[model samples]
Target: MSTQPTTDVAPSPPAPSEGGRPSDGLQAGLKNRHLSMIAIGGVIGAGLFVGSGSGIAAAGPAILLSYALVGALVVCVMRMLGEMAAAYPSSGSFSAYADRALGRWAGFSIGWLYWFFWVVVLAVEATAGAKILEGWIPAVPQWGWALIVMLVLTATNLASVASYGEFEFWFAGIKVVAIAAFVVIGLLAVFGVLPGAHSDTAGVANLTAHGGFMPHGPGSVLTGILMVVFSFMGSEIVTLAAGESENPQRAVSKATNSVIWRIAVFYLGSIFIVVSLLPWNSPSIVDDGSYVAALNTIGIPHAGEVMNVIVLTAVLSCLNSGLYTASRMAFSLGERGDAPKAFARTSARGVPRAAILSSVLFGFIAVFFNYKWPDTVFAFLLNSSGAVALFVWLVIAFAQLRMRAMILRDDPSKLVVRMWLFPYLTWATIGMISFVLVYMLTDPDGRQQVILSLLAAAVVVGIALVRDRLRASRPATASAGGVRDSAEGEESLPTGS
Candidate 1:
């Protein structure tokens, strides 16, 4: 008789589990519906809306290659993450996995780096959304709109996990619908089938019309990669959200199975339509957005405003998810002794109140610095965070190497989502990410982002080394009286080294 695999995991921790503190103290309030939508929505970020414009202009039709390349890279990383997460579900996600596979220091550095990344993202998304609102309403100053937007989302997150899930579900839905409609309508325009679509300029010819598909040559496609890759940043949020889902394995598996195609269609497919509908050199593309310009070509009323509203929704979705993710990671870190115990505490609604508030507080402070010195303070923060997503992915790739072997040594059945080509593809992904980081160093702007991020990572790593030393000397004090090895419950050797 054939046997089917099963998955029922007990969470993993950086240190031993303590007596009273829960790994997350999070409720299973996130429904399957919410999980699916969050997965779908998280893939579509505001970066695609605003940043894709720059990608198209730079790489022209060849930008599709950039998107596809990065999309494939994301697929490999996410699949590896899904594998570990399914076996050992944790709110900390990759950071927790890094701790188990690498070391406490590795986990500590990445956890804090990731939390820092999202907190910074919260500020960026809030600022972007505020600018759009302030444009619409003359009464509110930009800072006022920023404050209002951040507070509203913060309240939604603080209310309950379900409230955050519901808000993200709707926010992602709008982006999904908007992109789907844009693809359908834009494709028709390309083929000269849709009414009001200018077929004369919109067709396959547009691909070669300006300077040909490889207009800026192969090099631009690589540079386009730097631009296109960051848009895929939020895709990892799915596995993080899975910890709170009713069925974590199922949720992570589903998200892993489908994220690739979703990104391919939304990012690559959408860009294809834009390039097809108009020349890459079109002046209007940059100012109005490639999508907005395409809509204008078809004579849609208030096309720019319509796209702006959609962008705003994408921004809000990002802000909502960013806050939730950062807090959850902080919650996990606290539970593992990598953060303060207070952060591990949760309210009745299963919300990490201290973690959430701290994350939001940093976000608010970032927004303030953004206004005071947009060029200096906020720019440094942005650059420092620029490469963290890649760094996290790199850690995931390496963690999966050890994780996969360990899972096999323990029980392979729990790996519901397997990374393709195992060691080879895993090595290849690691190499590819390293290459991107190095490639960025060649450009002045990209170099700043990379250097700043590395400096930030180095600082975190130094802190982690000190913390690990302190923990080793006084484990009891570190975990607040003591921590029990859950390996007794997990029926395995201790995950910690």
Candidate 2:
């Protein structure tokens, strides 16, 4: 198979700028505030609202440490990516960086895999959002809500990038305020300060009183890690969105540098209060789910209804980001000739209309899978794509390691948002990712999904290798009397020519 590096030079072929729009299509419309909120909103998803209950149940309060561990690793990966992004910002983000620092195959494989990951995520979020909306308005079927949600977000994306930014900013802002309020209310209830509050159930003792922090033992910590990683998947979108900012470098640096604290405050801090106010093994905790249970425990009025709205918002936000990320990745692949050229075309508003439509269409199909085959097809889709989080994380680590050296070699000044401890931290992050993948193999629930995801990744990589070989084997030129080479490597020239 041909593995030519994308950066390898073979005579200049004139600039693509002549006929096509500049490589920065549709992205130039995003503003700074839109970017800042997207970074925040991307990290807080339905996982935080709903799935945290399972993690808390499994790991007890020690789930906080699980989130912290994963958060630290993400910080390292994002920092490395931010440094590279600042030096050479592009819509492709890691894929473009991989092409520059790694090779064509690396770019082709990771770009497609990342695109697959987000498209599946788009469907998952849509299904989740539909369920909540259906719960509120029972007259509409779940599938109907899913269609409406997908169509609405598709319209938002088909508009200018600025429209998307504005929509996401408010959507994300509401969730942020809700979580912040939860933290405050939970703290007051814990301290016996709020009216109608009960304090008998508060404090760190809740961590060990139920069954010790490792209630299910250290093995369950791995299980918790599996769930925890999914929540962190959207954090990388900041680096991707940063490419469109007026000052790409500053946007990346700011987002990467602050991720550590954001995780601490949003994920760990909120979970800490949840477990503090109630025993980890409480039936209500599992029955009502973590966030609702915590809110109900503090006697907060309308806690369930309030959190339902928040969770729904989180799901819609994820769907919006998923569609945006997937379409942008497809657009990048088209520009690099790895995908159909039509996906590369952009509207006057800079929106990648074809790419957006394609992603939304798949999302609509996934909603069908959710309704028609929730037990089989939907489960398989969830499991197969589950392992993609690890795969994408691994690619980010490798891309950063290679890109960092090139950036430092060419221009050291671009190291403003540098990773700590250089190669050691980078290698360490890779080790952690490897450990997570290995642990997935041993876990009963995650094993099949991990294997399926690995198989999917392998298939994509194989296709990339075969495509490279075919391109490499083709004749260099059909002109200059260089006839097509035949079976024995002999040129067959036209008799007249």
| Each prediction's whole-model lDDT (CA) | 0.83, 0.76
Q: How well does candidate 2 score on lDDT at residue 194? A: 78
In the predicted model 1, the residue pairs found to clash are: none
Model 2 stretches with alpha carbons more than 4 Å out: 1-23, 477-497
Which residue pairs collide, candidate 2? Answer: 26-350
TM-score of candidate 1 against the unseen true structure: 0.92
1-497 in candidate 1: lDDT tens per residue? 01111321223343312221124456677888899999898889898988888888888899989999999999899899988887766788888788878987888799999999999998898989999999999799999999999999989999889999999989999999999999998888888899765547888798987888989999998999998888888889988888777777788889999987898789888999999888998988898888888888877789988999999999999999999999998887776667877787777667778899999999999999899988999999999999999999999999999998887776666667898988999999999999999999998889999999999999999998886676567634232224334211111222322
User: How much does each candidate deviate from the true structure in C-alpha RMSD?
Assistant: 5.5, 7.6
| Segments in model 1 whose C-alpha atoms lie over 4 Å from true places | 1-23, 475-497
Instruction: Choose the strongest candidate by TM-score.
Output: 1
Q: How does each model score on TM-score?
A: 0.92, 0.90
lDDT of 2 by residue, 348-405 (tens): 6667788899888877777778778988997887777888877777887888887777
Report residue 61 deviation for candidate 2 (angstroms). Answer: 1.5
- Distance from true location, Cα of 227 in model 1, Å: 1.1
